[model samples]
Target chain A: MPIGIVSEPGREANEFKFITPDDEKLKTGEFVYYNVSLETEDEDSDLFSKTHKIFARVINRDECRGYPDSFLADPEVNPKHVAKKLGVISEDMELYRMTAKIIGYYDTRLNDFTNPRIVPKSGTKVELAPDDDLEKFLTNIEDVAEAFIGDLLHRNAGAVDIKLPVDNFTSTHLSILASTGSGKSYTCSVIAEELMKPDSRAAMLILDPHAEYHTLKEIEKMEEFKGNDGYKPKVSIWGPEDIRIRFAELSFREIISSLHNPSDAQEQRLREAWNRIQSSDDYGQYYSVNDLISECIPEDGSDAISDALTWRLRNAFDRELFDHSRNLSISELLEPGRVSILQLDTISAIDQQLIVNILFRKIYRERINCERNRDTQLDFPVFAILEEGHRFAPANGESRSLPILRTILSEGRKFGFGIGVISQRPSKIDDDILSQCKTQIIMQIQNPNDQDAIRRAVESVGEDLLSELPGLTPGQSVVAGDSVNTPFLCKIRERHTTHGAESLKTSKRWRESWTKNAQVPDKVVDADQDKGAEDREELL
Target chain B: MVSKKIGKVIGSNSHIDYTCEIYRKRDKDNPPTPADHSFGQFVYIEKEIDGKNIHLIGVIYDSQILDPDQGRTGPKLAEPHEQELFHPSYIEEKMTLAGIALLGYCEVDDDEFCSNEHCVPPWTIEIDDIVRTLSDKDFLKFHEVDGEINLGYYQNLMELAGPFGTDLLSKIIDQLKDMKPDEEKTLEVIQKNIEFSKRIKGV
Candidate 1:
């Protein structure tokens, strides 16, 4: 059915305003269509004798009441009474106008999309597009199940499944942007579930700040249906206790960048100590921070800064965190459809950089080697899902992971490598690297600066869509870039496994405790006494 | 095709494009105003020009109504002056008129009628043409083969059944539940919708 009549005409930077009667179905973000002609646009166009239907996304909605200004301008009548009258008068007083941007044309020939040029004349029809129509247009009517993430939420009215083309998206990298509690973890787990599908042939490595993705090993309860219903996931969990980076692998640049801040003399001593330790090669296999500090010597052989170096090294990190153990090979870390989650839940902020740096360097080397037929495990693509990216790849200060991460961003796609950087703070993340991620899955971001960062970084999604970021309810997101046929707003389907990282309901817990404690058993008590009786009680 | 009585064409203008005003007044005895004036409903006025059967399709997009001049007839309208209240004063009956914008004739330039196509006719609509909303048969016929508009906000607007809507998609699914194969995506959506509805009810 026609929802509105096209008020605007022609398709130069195409935009149109249509009066959508007082229908609530005609809303922003909905799709509408009108019949246009391809014949007029091209003289050689064949006489298909069909409607060259132009498709557009509703970006804005305006409401106009037919009431004259006299009602508002009148001071004699009570304003409250006037409002009541208007409410009782009728719905006819209100008019709804929908503004839509022409995204593209649904090309029936190629069965996908052709560059939209033809424009509908004034008074063309516009209506809500059905779910099946969307499915046909978006997927080109093919299953093409690459990495099925979620369903499209049609305003609490309808739902349809949607999938992403993973290989095409990985080259540009992806960012899952959301507010702290806006189903970010749930969405991430959905991606993990999709990747771990048997035919996906992709490996995922999650750097979990809260050890959330570690719950991928858990199977969903069968009583209620879920994604990970009956099968055991090929997932491994590695926490701080099971994690250690070999100190011998560290170069001078890596060591310097990893350290918090060292004075000129301290840096010299540290560098000299590392050089001496390398020369000896007899400090067993594993060398601690204490060992490196002990072997240090200034050029003048002074002990003035020895205590400072020792104290700084001891206080900066858990001295026992680093040890000279051979890092796990890529084969042990990654496998087809298997996920390795490094749980960094209990560690300090600085350690996140060190761990990511060490792991990233090893994966980079193995993948590069595999490319050259140099006997390595990473023959297939590896997707590293990095959480708290702003911490490791901060816009400001230096960090151990920054340089290695830069390399991965610049050339990882060429070598079957991609990274999914999950960050709540896009503004804090390095501008260069943040912009490099072409495919961005943005959720409910409320901060202005973060929204601005997204606007600057994302080129495909229009400002009209970006303006909607803050208003998006949880589980709703705008998927932009080449990952989708067109940049669309969709609701992610529910994950088969539990989103273990969900926030605790603190108020509910408090209320439940009160209810439970209300039934406290009566305790042994002394007989009640008056104020004066307490004085006589001692005598009694 | 017989259409549920929607409204009657009371006014029209062909100066810019074929536009008409539908007097959507309710008849207490036989009320048919509700379905007639909706913005997106496909409506048309039939015209026979030189033995050519023409169907000028249109959509009702706007509505307007002048406030009744109650000052001359009621207390509120007479607030400005005392003399107007006592005398026999009457205001014209206030009514709403839905504005209809013409899409085009149904294959006027072409020989064969394309049920799905929108065409621009060489002629405009006449003042005497009666405007009527599309029936379910015409609606189904045109929508099935004509155009399926796919939108970005598709997911947001779609609601699962038990609470039937203008689309009545849930009822359609319920009627076809046993007949639909399990392998189809349609079946999956229906099952999910049922589960979602059950969960919401339980909550």
Candidate 2:
């Protein structure tokens, strides 16, 4: 029962010096508890005294090991197994003391945990929190509208799988940052999966550039998590073929802004051409890019300006960037609690920007309308998620979508317009937007500049966590913000849906192909490929 | 035949108090492992004060073994081999010691024999007093005789209040299934303990 003894009285009432038995697991960040009766003065009282135990978090550990690592490394030195029988310099016969900060104590009278009012006397025996106590602390829910992200990890131990209130987490805006292979997208996928739960009614719109999340439509079918039967995420995938936006719906300034850095004079001339087409009876109603170009070609606003406008318009026309029907509405796609992924991979960069610009603008406007008027059809808040956010909200270069995104990040939450910016390079994300994101889901980031950027942006993340960021395993993240009771080091929970953004194992694929080709006849491989092509066609 | 004296009460603190510490030395002959002063093992601090042989009874609720020189003191630990040359090996070798936490004592009649009634002892022990094992044989000595007892004895031992009390209750429960003292005597002892707590609670 006496696992350890309080060695030092901490500067605070709750902090204590705990001398622990030298188990390899006895290290910093371990949780330990010391028994302390609330009424210390009632020494003679028996059953009436309210005895409570205070829980403390070990911040640092110090040990006097039996032998040097060098001595242990030396092959010539026989391990002192005899020491165990003698109870001398054995491996387990070492002393370790941990500096633990008292977290809080359970109030038996109030039936809830409260901050420590009295410190346990020095030499207090410390023990591991019983399973029940640990479970109660970790599983206590702060709010009902919580977003289930992952299991909270306590010093390599799983405390509990708890939820983070999305109302606090998302409405304040959030950023998921990590290196390319550090499970950044997987973390986002977990969030997406949670959002798309059948019972959830929060809308999430993912601006996916590589069509990474389109497979979410069949994610529940993934063999690993097929047990999650009730988890059906209402996913709507929008690709260029499935979506159409009228060119006439875009303003003259929006049209000119999509050009490759059009000069001020060129912008002015294009604006005049667009004005002339709208003013005329034949094309005044709703003009397409072709009509705008034809009007520009006959304009008297200089031939050079008309030629530039025509070339830009012709390029957009060739790409089939627009349709007469304005059918893609964020209100329709990002319905409450539904997950919609726009596969912008098929669209050109210029057209991608124009489309993202329009989508974000519409979402922002809808949220504003919803906030102002309760009668708005889509009354719920929506989180606009941008994958590879660096492309859209780059710190260095300006993009057509940046202005509206900046506006959303700054004031969107006020109107139930939340933003989730997923980025690998936190340093490359616009500081204004990054700073506005109150909750930061930081995964393993090895870059010092990115770490520095995160440090400057997130005041809640301490030096200890910042130091630990680079060493975190994939799918492990530190959640720091007002959303959680405290900053949590957590292992992301298994996604109910298949992780659609996982990188292909190039080596494994190559090995399978080469080995199969060598073993099988060319005719057989050809037939297999033909069949695979047919299967793929059917899947499409 | 005198049994081996495993430890002695440290005179600096009051042995009469419900809780006390016993220090034991391990030499060449006694290479005492943690097993020597295991938890839940009951013992007695025996002394001849004014030729009145006394026994201060308690249970070993906890034990701490230390070779201070080898065991780091401060929260600051040095590098893996930090104290290799700085600390004297002689200190570690000679200072190997154990301290057992003893809480709960019982009352004995004038004839130096325990009775059905137990109480917190009034006498303390000197450093010279010997700490000897209080085995099941010693527990059986408190057979049928009645004596003045502490009113809170039931709360201290039967209700399972302190470390020793809980351990004693557990020990009794373990023995109960095997009918160590038979059902009648066990029932009588339990009834007496509850009656004592009820009387104290009424007061």
Candidate 3:
């Protein structure tokens, strides 16, 4: 039979079998089967004829082909009686065409075919080819969003080694820039999740200025599949320990300097007093700055040391001295074997900056000490993820913590500690810190300042890639750094939980409020009558 | 009998003692006399009993000064004072006569017997000195003739002769004389003799 020709009305055309047939004359790679199907005219018609438009090659003419019985038993014609009537004979009656090219054959098995193109009698054709457009193939934004979140639970083992291909984020610094509602929270969460993986060996400490990351608690409890089991992600939260300065554990100098003084002379006196106290054996043992000041300043004459000491003692003893107790200290939060989050929800931006600086300094000091004391060459490495980093490490040298944080950005790598900064205003973050980041997982960032900042930070990022950044769909990020083979946009694997980034649904809320309060005059009168009748019934 | 032979080989009659004095002027104008001297110097002399030319020097301080007239020839006139007054000069002269006397008995020429210069005793010897000279090999041969010598005894005596002694050469000759011509034994003896000689010469 000629290939691609439909069968005539009453001709005995060739029967195509996927396996060995009654006619042993068919050769390998030769067209053997005539594609035919039954067409129904009206709602009920028993008379059916074969309509052929496709052909199959004799890929395996030596073996019997087994066809699924359901395919042979037409469901529409005889749904209830089909299975009983068809039985094993269904395999011989059904027809199949060779839909692929037979490349080679194996003696033990059958020949292998590739690029299968299935042309059903009336349905859409299905094409099977090697994946050439991997990016496009996986480019479905919704699917990628789901995978980006879903993969957080069913973590592929290969995912742990997939670092964002950048260098020196911790040592150099970085920023996350996007519009307020443009999945900045979700992108930060994804970065946090990637860093928190066991192999990443990173510690995520979110400053959480707006308390937005409190949702992470719920996300961490989302279902994660392991083999056949499920688990909840684990993270630890830390806040200020107590109201006292001793409990807060500020270094003596930090406490003295943070105090407010009336004049330059008072400040100088306070400095000398602080120096004396620090040089003394009993420094930093006091319960509050007031106690420390009271002990340092003596009741005396108008010498600069005596006058300054008295003023400092009086001023620092006030309630304002304990103002720092509201913010948390990093030393209290840094416990080994746990991912610590220092939520700075209660503090202002300036105070948060101070707290983050203290935390970074403490962590850097501890890591350096640990490395120095290690007996062997290999030591455990730690990563510190700084969320909302712009407040602490700001552009234009405004942030009080910038200098120290810049030091960390420039030197943290050699100490085996890394830093990750997440911000929505990349332009506002320190350039020194941002430029040091070797890996960048850029999400949708539309702001020109943020784009320019990112462009300046990553010198190697091309203009083409930079232009593509603002248009990136939710959950899709462009990963570029030493970790990635190339700068390619990746569909972030889905998170395991449904707790996506919470966004303000303004229109829906407004419409729901309007509908809730909408009423007519007649409805109000009926409602008043119903209430009166109910009251009368209750009296009876 | 070996003792007598050894005594003759060592030249018992040719034994001599020579003494020399070194003087220091305490003060140039009024030098202290020997009687008033607080310190004195002497040599503890050793003579090689065998023909080996070994000499040892030892310095002595505060040694007793014996009567110089007892050993000197033309200086003993009368009293002990007279002898004491010229004792330093007298001892110097006696030391020179002793050197002459020893030179006359041996083949060592006068030029080789100076006190101030380093010299070696002559290898060639007069008949009188030959009778007196007991070479270590001759001493070992005397022991062998008296039937007192065993392989171990001869080995010990040869060891004392060290590598510079003629005993090693004599042992090589004796090894070559065995009628059975034990080439292996002869070579072993020669090698051991060479090793001994090298050790003594420190080469």
- Per-residue lDDT of model 2, residues A56-86, tens digit only: 6666677745543422432443335222211
Distance from true position, residue B22, model 3, in Å? 99
For all the predictions, what are the DockQ values? 0.01, 0.01, 0.00
**Order of models, best TM-score first:** 1, 2, 3
Task: Give per-residue lDDT, candidate 1, residue A535.
Answer: 71
TM-scores for every candidate against the unseen true structure? 0.60, 0.59, 0.43
Q: Model 1, B21-135: lDDT tens per residue?
A: 4443333455446556654566777777787667666555555675556444533534446534653333224555666655445533353445433333466666646777766
lDDT of 3 by residue, B1-203 (tens): 11011000112222221222323242134332343321211112223435433322211112234444474567446576665475557534331111111211111223132222112222222222211222333333322312222222233223333432344434433533342242334233434444545566665
The per-residue C-alpha lDDT of model 1 at residue A485 equals 62
CA shift of B142, model 1, Å: 43
Q: What docking grade does candidate 1 earn?
A: incorrect
Clashes of each: 23, 3, 33
Question: Higher TM-score: candidate 1 or 2?
Answer: 1
* lDDT per residue as tens, model 3, A6-79: 21111112222232223323333233223335442443756566442233333322333444333333334332
